[model samples]
Target: MTSKYEIRLNSKIDIRRIYTNETLPLRKKVLKPFLTEEECINPGDDLTSTYHFGLFQENKLISISTFIQEGHPDFLSTFPYRLRGMATDTEFQGQGLGGILLQHGVEYLRQKECDFLWFNARIKAFPFYEKLGFSYYGPLFDIKDIGPHKVMYKILIPK
Candidate 1:
């Protein structure tokens, strides 16, 4: 029998705010398979100001991302939101689901008058982010078990 998710692949897609827990399965599967379920939870995920976004087709969540109202010391923005645990299911890779979800988050941040959105992006995902207007912020660095990554940011409300 075809799974509900597979059936929804051709259905309408929706992007909206989702709970932090809703983001974990995809985070573990696509972004941190080596980590335990508890380890997949990112810092500040439960904060009141934190926001999680998901792309869903029917009832199936295909892509997920989390944003925290935390600022990097390097960024002088008065209101900076940090992106974390972004993942698109392997079967849904290259479908632009992640980008569409991210853009939706950007619009949400813009509405909140955020100054910028920043994150430590995996080296391989650089082009994906760059295409969406995020610029590299600092030199490449290692995130322990995660390999090479660079700080990337996009200004939402310039100061």
Candidate 2:
């Protein structure tokens, strides 16, 4: 016997553009736990073309991801977006909130005429990015003690 099922959340979530300061603690907690909050701040985070998206439930910021107008050195495009500092609160992990954040983030970038979004995805998080239509390129490399990572990109094909 075989069966398939799904559960849709009718719950309301606010996907909003948030300031970088609003994202630091969650970024430190989820992404850069071993380092100081100062270490979690990425290079292009303060750029005018960078946009940080946060998922809020009942006014509590739960998950966040940043999109910047930085192209992958390998993937050339007029407006390639780089996805950075994506993190969901540990308490809310495995509930599909990360997927929601990516979906909304992609749409927002597409409207700005971005050709694609790319990032250095962690090995453990590879499956999650794959599910959202991102593919990998380049050899496996490392960041000091942060483990291995590969460059992954998702193209927003025109409809």
Backbone clashes, each candidate: 0, 0
Clashes of 1: 0
lDDT string for model 2 (1-159, tens) is: 111211223456667778888889999998888988888889989999999888877678899989888887777687889999999999998989989988888887787788888999999999998998899999999988688999999887533
Candidate 1 lDDT, tens digit per residue, 1-159?
343212223447777678888888998898888987678998899998998888887768999989899999987888889999988999988988889888878878887889889999998999999999999987899988889999999989732
Model 2: lDDT of residue 75: 70
Alpha-carbon RMSD, each predicted model: 5.2, 7.1
Shift in Å, residue 82, candidate 2: 0.4
Model 1 off-target regions past 4 Å? 1-11
lDDT of 1: 0.85
Q: In lDDT terms, which candidate is top?
A: 1
Candidates' lDDT values, in order?
0.85, 0.84
On a 0 to 1 TM-score scale, where does candidate 2 land against the true structure?
Answer: 0.90
